[model samples]
Target: MAARRITQETFDAVVQENVDEFGLDPAEALAEAVEQFESQGVDLTNIVKAVQSGASEDAKDNQTHTVLQILESLRGHVGTANVDGMPADLKRFTEQCKLGFAQRYLAAQKDAYPTILACCRKVDGEKASLLAALDALSSLTDGQPDLLDAGGREFLMGILREHPDDPAVTVLAVRAVRHCCVKHEQNRQDLVKAGVLPLLTATVSRYSAQPELLCEACAALRVMTFDDDIRVPFGQAHDHAKMIVLENSGLKVLIEAAKAHPDNTSVLSELCGTLSRLAVRNEFCQDIVDLGGLTFMMSLLADSLDHQDLVKQVLSALRAMAGNDDVKDAIVSAGGAELIVMAMNRHIGNAHVCEHGCASLSVLALRKPNNCRVIADSGGLLVALQAMKAHPKALNVQKQACMVLRNLVSRTQELCPVILELGAEPLIRQALASHQDCGDLAQAALRDLGCEVELRELWTGKKGSLTQ
Candidate 1:
């Protein structure tokens, strides 16, 4: 009950004592020590019991365990091996690369991407082999987006097109598409143009019961709407998001599909995040409210107060939707203000929830004076200050907490002295001094809170300076 734990050193000492002092055999001594620890109620979950080390560790046989060898073997197997049975080698290769970041990167460096893609194409009709190959492709493309070229994009769309109804195949292929699109703007535009959007919305519609498939599809859809590629001068992120919402009926499909997975925290989290990203335009923000997303998310946040992940996403959606003034008033009217504070207090240690919770409160308090008072009345100020203290190193938390304080005191100036008395000035100054991005927002928060802060001016109306 109290962790009932034993260190490996202590356990090994007892085992050695049995071997040397009691004159027992090594194997028998190990067994005796295990039995003795179990009999005394010691938990051995963390202790590494005796086991043979992996061959990769041995300097004697490095090439035998290398992923490169496995990739070559897989390529040969897929090229000639019969597809009548499950490709055991392909499955093994995928399993090896699935968990290790370095392994996947190494595999990608060995040109494993093309091999895996070709295998997926070759194993088209074989469901088991196709799944294994797709899993392998997903792993190879995890952090190696540069490996994904136009051919790989075509192959991904082909898979989705060929196996639209098969959740097993579509899920893996959609995931491969997601891994390809992240931080790769050209791929995002190419896949969306290649008709990946409707296929994704259709996947959600066809397989709402399969939460795993829906999660992948949702995540993929969200990826297509990203402008993460900094090298590109312009990105089609906004256009892709609009297509998902306007052309593909993403809102209705997602909101309808959401009905099937209310009890699942992970799926709900993804769906909330996708909806937030889609809330870019005013009418789009209103569309989320019109399509029952707002009410559903409020209910989600209220129902799943104890779930940290869900709360964080729900608060994010709320914050995004509040970009519309009417939605802002609506959120406060529905008692979302107090739920946010309560959620922050419930999961105070989670920096994500605190950041989103503060951002949501900040947006709600932007121009609405009454909402500001409602948030403050619900201990919003204290919760924010607590987050600033709890996660000092979290720049986003510091920035958003400063933002919430600024917005909270922006309209309702009465609460300024109250927050300052709780020592809000030093934290604001600390955030200001610590983060470069926090300089202006933290200073604005300090200035708005009626504290003494240095506000820099860039223009002093110098003669002929404006022309330059």
Candidate 2:
């Protein structure tokens, strides 16, 4: 296609009648028409005049779609690939294109969901699609959340990775990654490796008082740390994992986030959970202790209401901390058993939470059967029994509860007969009724009771009641 002179008549036709055909801005319509005209050996001067003459409120407004299309067209045009590649003339046009799209997108933010969606689809499906252009437009505006996607994410990350310390792009990339990387461990790790973690850490420490960014940073950190397969890069040579948290500054940031966002239950819960795992080292535990995290944990458990996940996380952390006799005593003194019993009863619908709650209970029951008795007295026995009534349907819960009951009996010895006398067998019957595992647990419990035959008969749906 030879560059031909675009006649003024054709250019003006495109600009004036854009709404009739393309429904786009006049400058953008004229630019695209001019590109086509130039490709066909048309004069460029007439095209420029048509574009400039047609730039009006309505033509500008209509040009938005055309502008987006131009950006899309520019994506593969090597001249605008990166900041370094941008020629001045092309850069000016790109900036103008971005401004046009931004203006239109903002005005129609609610209605522009479809346009952004289209941009994401193109970028993800095609390797060289205009993600950077769409992202730039997205960054300048708010309420265009659909722009956050794998393609949008990769594009932003690419920019940030290329320009490591550019705070503006880095900040946008971090913010974008936080909202988009929740479910993908590899993506999260990529962001971390791209120096995102350090950037986020700096933000947290610099704006130590910014609760929202701190919360997001903590969430990203929690996700990264929890990926069992991906290990944090150690800053020191002593031990990779140990160095990742201990010798380096990362752990301090986490501790500060926990202390910084005490009112943020979600942040505290995740922080405590991560800290509990990190507390395998005595030094880490001491750091946690020095930071007053243990007290925060107990208080979160006691005071934070209606947060089942937080409660469960705190309980798990407490369970980790329970190795310390003082911690165990503190838990018992803080009504840990009672709180757990409530969690158990309240989350009967969620098997995992119930399982963890019961695991925590089993931990406490093993410590002091009197606490188990407290649990038993608090309708906990009833809850566990009811849980078993469904049996193999929720085998994990039953297995955990069985463990708890076994722990209770072993510790108290006095509760075994009461457990049986209180009709726990009926639930065992329901449990075994589902599968062989239930039969095994029922058999083991009976063996523990020194009444295998009688218990076996009861488990098989016998008419005789333990109380009767």
Best by TM-score: 1
Candidate-wise lDDT, in order? 0.84, 0.56
Off by over 4 Å in 1: 1-64, 78-86, 461-468
Task: Report model 2's TM-score to 2 decimal places.
Answer: 0.54
- Report the number of the highest-lDDT candidate: 1
Evaluated at residue 303, the lDDT of candidate 1 is 95
lDDT per residue (tens digit) for residues 1-468 in model 1: 575887655776777678679998768888998899999989876443432123453432332335666777777766785654336767777776765665676576567887787787788777887888788888788867788887888888888888887778888888888888889998888788789999999998999888898889899999988888998989998999899999998988988888788899999999998888888888888888888888898889999999998898899889989999999998888889999999999999999999999899899999888988998888999999999999999999999999999998888899899999999999999898889999889989999999888766566787656435
lDDT of 2 by residue, 1-468 (tens): 644554444566666576458787756776677566667666563223434322455564444333334443444343332433222323333354345433334323333333433443344333223334334334433323333445555565565455444444444445555544544555555555555555555655654565555555555545455433324343222232253465446667667767777677766766666665555554555556556666667677767757877877876776666555555555677777777777766666777667777677776677675676777777666677665654347777777777777777776777778888877665665565666675666656555554543443334456776555
| Superposition error at 436 for model 2 (Å) | 6.6
